[model samples]
Target: MHEVSICEALLDQLTSLAAQQGWPRLRRVWVRLGLLSGVVPDALEFAFAAMATGTPAEGAELLLENEPGHFDCAVCGELELERMDFTCPQCGGALQLLRAGRDLWLSGVEPMPS
Candidate 1:
């Protein structure tokens, strides 16, 4: 649902970047998908595939990197935990959620050389 909008926004950004950088074709897009960003990877990929037809990103590869959430346990200082895993194994303490996993962002873009 919202992934479509998100993909559309990504495409818009890619287009703008290509124009600004004078790149003719988009070769690859590297995206970091945060663990708790509430975005479905499959849906995002599907949206990209469907929307990229006849666009500059026609043959681009969408590389998705899963970014895990971070938590701060009073006893453990800081810890990296995957989605829904909020318990500290070291000291059996509940972790306070951090801001490491709440964004879906474009990390980098590789363009085809002219």
Candidate 2:
């Protein structure tokens, strides 16, 4: 799966950040996973665990925070959709996507105790 590649990139970023910030070991990695990002959480976690071997991030907990898809309706202002639906419930107007839930980013990190 592409999650492996994603994890590789994530690890690269983590490595750079750790060196820049002088973190010896990482304890936790926090990520924001959008609902429609097409990346499976389980797959990502598995990839991370597999790829993190012998690295500073080994044994690090990968925490995911889900971000819901958001839309803007002419009549409803804003709406949060759990699934794909382009119609506004209130006025049946066409909903415009404000956030497509395609965001994937590292939000925070926790380092091991010195």
Candidate 3:
């Protein structure tokens, strides 16, 4: 699954970050997952846990935060999507994506206790 590759990339990023920041290890990792990211949370967690073995991030807590999908309607301004529908309720027009629910990124990290 691509989740394995995703975890591998994440570990690489964590390793680089720890080196750049001079941190001994990472205790936690916070990832922001969008509703449309297509990445499974359970799969990501399982992959990360497995891939983190013997690494600096081993035993680190992987926390996921959901980013709600937002859309912009020509006649309705910005609004949160409802039921994953792309139609505007007020104007019956197409809704364009504005923000959220389209990306997967690391938001924060906690360094291991000294």
Candidate 4:
């Protein structure tokens, strides 16, 4: 799945970062996952565990933070959620999608001492 490729890319980045910082190992990898992102958390986790084997980040914990989707309604003057077709609930006007939840990134990492 795409998560496997995502994991591969992530490990590659981590390896480069670890080498640059002289970090012995990674204790945790914190990432923020957008709700609209099609990547599955469980699948990503599994991929990370499998891909990290034998690497410095082998035993590292992959933590995910989920973000929700949001839309802005011009008539409402603020962001809204829980509406289908992206139409304003009050004014029936078309709503603008502010966040589509497409994000996969590393937010933080705990590096083990050398």
| Cα lDDT, all candidates | 0.86, 0.88, 0.86, 0.82
Q: Give model 4's TM-score versus the native structure.
A: 0.76
Scored by Cα lDDT, where does model 1 land? 0.86
Predicted structure 3: lDDT? 0.86
Model 4, 17-98: lDDT tens digits are 9899888799999987776677889999999998999777899999998765677787686664632347876788888788
Clashing pairs in 4: none
Per-prediction TM-score, please?
0.85, 0.80, 0.77, 0.76
lDDT of 2 by residue, 1-114 (tens): 779888998999999999899998899999988877788899999999999887789999999888778899988799887667789878999998887767589999999989
Worst 10 residues of 3 by lDDT: 81-90
Q: Model 1, stretches more than 4 Å misplaced?
A: 89-92
Off by over 4 Å in 4: 73-77, 80-96
Instruction: Let me know the TM-score candidate 3 reaches against the reference structure.
Output: 0.77
The 10 consecutive residues of candidate 1 with the worst lDDT sum are 80-89
Candidate numbers, best TM-score first, in rank order = 1, 2, 3, 4
Sort order, lDDT high to low: 2, 3, 1, 4
- Pitting candidate 3 against candidate 4, the one with the higher lDDT is 3
CA-only RMSD, every prediction: 1.9, 2.6, 3.2, 3.6
Residue 67's lDDT within candidate 2 is 76
Q: Candidate 4, overall lDDT?
A: 0.82
Model 3 backbone overlap count: 0
Clashing pairs in 1: none
Model 2 poorest 10 in a row by lDDT: 96-105
